[model samples]
Target: MKATIERATLLKSLSHVQSVVERRNTIPILSNVLIEASADGAIKLMATDLDLQIVESISAQVEQAGATTISAHTLFDIARKLPEGSQVLLHAAEGKMLIQAGRARFNLSTLPRDDFPVIAEGDLPTSFELPAETLKQIIDKTRFAISTEETRYYLNGIYFHVSDEGQPVLKAAATDGHRLARVTVPRPDGADGMPGIIIPRKCIGELRKLLDEVEGSVAVSLSASKIRFGLGSAILTSKLIDGTFPDYSRVIPTGNDKLLKIDPRSFEEGVDRVATIATEKTRAVKMALDRDKITLSVTSPENGTAAEEVSGAFQGEGFEIGFNARYLLDILGQIDSDLVELHLADAAAPTLIRENDRSPALYVLMPMRV
Candidate 1:
């Protein structure tokens, strides 16, 4: 197979597919990307790691129409280092692939295209289209809370299901038996009968990258075992985790007795400064909510203590709670509003956080036992 493609275009396509190729692999073909040159001068690149797969296509100049598999990382590096807009020539011969760009030439080992695994597209029971930005909103808000614990494999993904109100809802929840984060997106139309699916953490990561390039609408195809996302020039397919996510609705506190509103940035920065004195084990910073002001303080036996006051817009009944500083920052970073609202029942009850803008996003934090 022989084809000529622009260095930039080739590099961009390779960049998207190579990320799916693992660095270490037991199967020889899994490390390589399948490149096919069609008669119409279009080049396609595909790579997979058994469970996840990516395929992308770009325009190229084809001299001979055929297909070959070559190392994704190596080819990407070569194309990336080459001069911009330069024409790159690729040809496969004698179980080796050759690359020529400007004055530089490279010969890479090749694998048989037949050995590469392809995920079969099954007849999806449900299919829908939604804006890529909408999908991204659910992912970015909840992905951080996905648990890394292997024993509870089901909690390793964001759960997408219909909410109790019969609204289409997407939720991400994770717990190390300590803290939990839950984010939901209102269900779009055409997803009424869709069953809840646990999207793996890795799939969420890759989906974020794909959505960045997509705007209008992304076509979604789902089966019992797999999910496919088609974003114009690329296709992402991955196996869904087959397990049940815990009932996250119960964990949210409905009886939060105290409500405090403070500047999101001020609360974030105050926690950052005071937490420096917090014990490394607990990382707990105590918050004192008084009339029109919030005080953040942390005291460590060996490290001393630090305190900072952040003015608030309300003067509710004073309440104090201890929380992990890092956790507070993580949730606050996702809030785009200037003011953050914290609802508290007591130091023991979980605190509910929401932005003043009445956005759909809500975060619940379990206070650290300090």
Candidate 2:
């Protein structure tokens, strides 16, 4: 295989596909990327780690049509160090893959193309297209709540399903039994009959990073076992978690009457100030909501005590609740609105948090015993 590709273009595609290659692999072939240079002036790079895979293509000046396998990280590292605007030439022969850019050149070990495994592309019946901005919003708001605990594997990924309760909309939700975040976008066409799928946490992380540079819409297709996303020049396919996600709807509070409306920036700042005194173990901050003001305080036996006041609009008598400072910041960081609405029931009941925007999104927080 012989092809010449622009350094920037090759580096970008290499960055996309090399992330899927595991740093440590038991099988030698699993560490190498499958590079295929077609006669039609395109170079394809593919990498997989059994459960997840990424394939990306870039235009290249192909002199011969052939395929080869080389280390994903090694090629990316070499391409990344190449001078800007330089052209990269790739040549594979015998058992060595030669990479040349400007005056620098390196020969890397090659592996048999047949040793790489391909995730069977079975029929993915459900297909839809989601705007890149909408998908980014959903992932940004909900992924913070994805649990790290492996015991309940279902909580490790966002649950995506169409909720047609009052209005037909697509929802993405994640919860760690402490806080829950749910975001929505208008239901896309051709996804009404799709089953709920739990996209693994690792897959969501990678997809979110890719979407940072993606615009327009992403092609999404799924089955009971797998999910695929087609970004402009790249495609990602990942296996869905097999376990059943818990009934998350049952925990969302519906009748929280007490309302507290506050400036999100001011509230977040007050929480940060008070949380400085919070213990490292709990990182708990107490929110004492009153008829027009909220007193954020932290009292730790060892660290110290601190308090601050954030004024807001509240109708009910008063309410006091405690939450993890880190979790509060995570949820608050995702809110893009100036006003934040807190619907409260009691100290123990889950409190609902929503933004003051038309775009539908809500968060539920379980109080901590402070």
Best by TM-score: 2
TM-score quality measure for candidate 1: 0.95
**Which sections of candidate 2 miss by over 4 Å?**
356-358
Model 2 Cα lDDT, one tens digit per residue, 158-238: 999987867788989999899999988879999998999899999999899899888899999999899999999999999
**Candidate 1 local lDDT, residue 48:** 91
Tens-digit lDDT track of model 1 for 161-267: 76655554644455544556666666666666777888888888888988888879999888777899999899999998999888887888887767788889878
Per lDDT, the best of the predicted structures is 2
Off by over 4 Å in 1: 164-177, 313-316
Query: Which whole-number lDDT from 0 to 100 does residue 154 have in model 2?
Result: 89
Root-mean-square deviation (CA) per prediction: 1.8, 1.2
lDDT of each: 0.83, 0.90
User: Model 1 Cα displacement at 164 (Å)?
Assistant: 5.8
